[model samples]
Target: MMKKNYITAFDGLRAVGVLAVIAYHLYPQTVQGGYLGVVLFFVLSGYLITDLLSREYRKNQTIDLKGFYLRRFKRLMPLLVTVFLVTSLYLTAFQPNMLNQMRMSFVSALLSFYNWWQIAKGGSYFANLMAEAPFKHVYSLAIEAQFYMIWPVILLLAFKLIKRRSLLIFSLLLISILSGLEMALLYQPGQDPTRVYYGTDTRLFSLLIGASAALAFPSQDQRLAKLVRARQKGLNRLFLLAMLLMLASLIYLSGQSDVIYRGGMFSFSLLSALLIVLSTQANLYLTRFLSNPLFRYLGERSYGLYLWQMPVFTLFELKFPGATGSWLVLLELILLLGLTEIFYRLVEKPARSVKWQSFKEKGRVFFATPATIGKAVGISSFYTLAFIGIFAMIGIFQAPDLSYAQETIAAQLSQNQTKEKLGQASMSQETIETLSQQYEVSSQVFVQEEPIAIVGDSMIAMTYDHLRQAFPTAYIDGIIGRSGEHGVPMLEETLAQIPDAKKVVISLGINTDGPVILNRNTIDQMMSVLADKEVYWMTINLSQSQYTWTDQVNAELQAASQTYDNFHLIDWYQATIGQESAYLAEDMTHPNQAGQVLYTKMILEALAQ
Candidate 1:
């Protein structure tokens, strides 16, 4: 293949893609739509690869399959393997719980089918569980790799069979459309779209759009070249507009938005294709900006940046929980850049320089030194010792007591259940004692005098008296094994019965069975009914056994507070994050007396607010 001049603008685009992904990973709320950066990368790969293959075909009259694969390996694998080794060693040393998963994920990533692997494991790309999959981001890389594997054969065949640019363009367009339609048809609202999101069939449109552009505007096509040159000024303006549109989409589109999977993704592909088309021309303001030194440098290191961001963020967040702010984010970026520079210098550059015929000689020259051998052996020994140390710590700190802890947690749960049942029995016993101890006036119009209505499940029941004590004029409606859905209707009924009472405290969601979406639905339903009332919703804390749903439910509750003016979160989740284990009764889910007290305090604080 003829050596092509490097375009600095492409590096700028690369920087855009990588930064978006990093932003999305670290601060998802701020850049919810940054996943579209993956689409941009896909498009860029298709465009550049197609351009490369076209040049190769024009030069040699055929594609060199072995050479192409080798080139791709050199381009992608060195950094990938380095990251995998480092990540695996780190995980084994620090988070043994992740070892089994890392093994599967690492192998899947190595084979370039991680996206499908995740689908097979029933993992959702956009779900919170993605945090568990260390190599989840590699799914996009896998997709591009899959494209690279098959696109050449398909393109070669198309060129051999059709031999016309028009036919090739038509075929690419058809394929892209079919892929888009497949994605649209496969997507279902209110369900995990992992299959659709991760499947190559659903994601092929972006690549094909780029491919079609390459076919449509072949470098050697004089007629098209003349036409493009004639309209260069207008085309530059159009490209500038296209660039703005891409930026706008990145800013405005969110992963939660329905339009993303259905049609917006395809729209993004078109915009990316237009940007590529603009990149081929010079003298454009957008191109000049993209060709700037900063963009070019970042773009050059973008691959390493993308490869390292997830693991780095994951480890950093785990090591420094709750560490945030501008300075920390800047520090993260600097670390990412520094690591990428090292990888680029030591791994990527050398790998790129390797020649297949002289591979053994190059290897010999690189690895013959005593220092290299010593370094490798030393690093291996360090990792082995670290692994041993980590396991020793685990055994000393956790392994021997693991069974006892489970038993204790189980016993605690059983005790809470028994207490709950006894409390229910006591409710009737206390009523009987009151009836027998004091004479009731038959003529007294049975009126509930409480102004505050508190409703919840067993957790709320456990703390019912505490809540009543805190707000003496409070009506408590708590049931054992109840969920948020069951409580909303009762809340509405309570509001109806106590029309004079405008303030209500809801402490449901500890036993919610589904994901955040389901919990959010419960909140939305409750808000629709009690939109006029001052509702203070208590966030939940579940034992480690139900921690996943616990966190998600609290997140939904917090998000709801932002959306609804009348809905205020009591923030029991934050209050109990590190303290819940101490406050948990026998039942891992229910709060003990101390937890109940804290819960009451949180509610009172919310009321004060």
Candidate 2:
């Protein structure tokens, strides 16, 4: 807790974690695997907390459970409470609907069980098309808090009975191995891995790895610390290797990587533990580089940065329209750092500096007077109004997700149809026949010899009704969550059913597993199915927050369109580029009514041409 005891290089690691997480949230395309930063933090926490607990047990032969808990509360709660209160107030005042949706998550966060709560709600961390939750990052905090409470007790029991550092280290190693094995065993392919990712049982290995490191190199024991640092050359080389691997993990690892849930986490944690050990004793250039002022400053305020980041980015999305490009993301980082600095100074610093004896001490103050109370009330009111004003302006300027709007329209249409059907049934037979003739005359149903075949993913499913209205006899096979790989097979089945069809529209590529690239072979096979017919290919308009390979998929589609005479490209990417949030659902990938209309119109216009 003291300045002398502080490991400066570890602060640098903290900076890495914060930067990775923030970058991933604000600009996911840049850091596809940055969520691993949370794993880094977990390992670091396990090391530090275990060191402290071990030190306490050695000195007094008993752990101060009360003091430890109080310290944790002081260090963590103030900023968390402030952020929660501010976010809740803003949501309630401006986005009241979000408040209802977030209530369960909010409660879970407050209770420090957000990970389990999200799992219970069937949340998928890697689902590209799911809407963002405001408190999604709190899952990591829940895991850390759970470890903070439980690990010390485990350490106390181990130290009391085993009475040997080597045995404690061995025991932690065994538990870590078992934890990793459990994660691998629990993992199921083709299912949401969020249950595995969020589960404490599966994630405990990272923390235990760090704990094992603490036992191997006790930071507080001066003699042991000196002994570890004695072989400075060997320690430095190990530190360098760990740094390289850590950077490699950050640069390359992704949630989509099969290894991440299957022993990949354990591998990363071991690297992190090595970094911690090297941080304490290596004294290498990497250590010095990590201990620089800028890195240390960012690291020191990492907690505040982590807590405020998602809310700030979500606010940016709510306030601004379209995709968040590099410039906007840079601006967000600056704002995030600025706000985090302010939070650290005003809230975190004060919380850490003040040592309260009891809960009652919170009621007592340095200046207890009517003037002080009035000042407090005035400040509170100002903050409330400021948050409300900020959110209200965002609401007014930025358009809301049109998915809800589409739902409302659908519900109204269904009700009207029900009423009209009832009225028609009650009418006389002659009158009903006359009305039916009028309806048939107005309705647009193509009576061509060869109907167009439409094939694609969920985007096609969204425009199915509109497509039906436009091309009534078209053979539309739009499967939800279908990928480009499945398109050829679906096309085969649809063409078999509608063999006379002379034209087809393929709208594939929105829901590919990882980085979406147009498979040339698949397209060629589909072309063979429609040898003499014209084929229209629709480019993918992906959400920047959701998919990383939208541009790649679009580029490939455009290139393919130019390569072949029969293959025509419909520029869905260009058509819906800036109007993403407006036309698409909250996920910013799937189409709503506006998007459906836009897509349908484009197809109709192309057919006329």
Worst 10 residues of 2 by lDDT: 416-425
State, as a TM-score between 0 and 1, how close model 1 is to the true structure: 0.67
| lDDT, candidates in the order shown | 0.68, 0.69
**lDDT, candidate 1, at 371:** 37
Off by over 4 Å in 1: 1-5, 130-133, 219-225, 362-609
- Leading candidate by lDDT: 2
Question: Candidates' TM-scores?
Answer: 0.67, 0.68
Cα lDDT of model 2 by residue, 317-384, tens digit: 55553344678777777888888876676567767756465326665321221232365754564466
For TM-score, the strongest prediction is 2
RMSD of every prediction = 10.4, 9.7
Expressed as tens digits, the lDDT of each residue in 328-441 for candidate 1 is: 778888888888886676566666775656756554322122232365754564466456545543433331223233334334332332332111122244443443233222
Cα lDDT of candidate 1 equals: 0.68
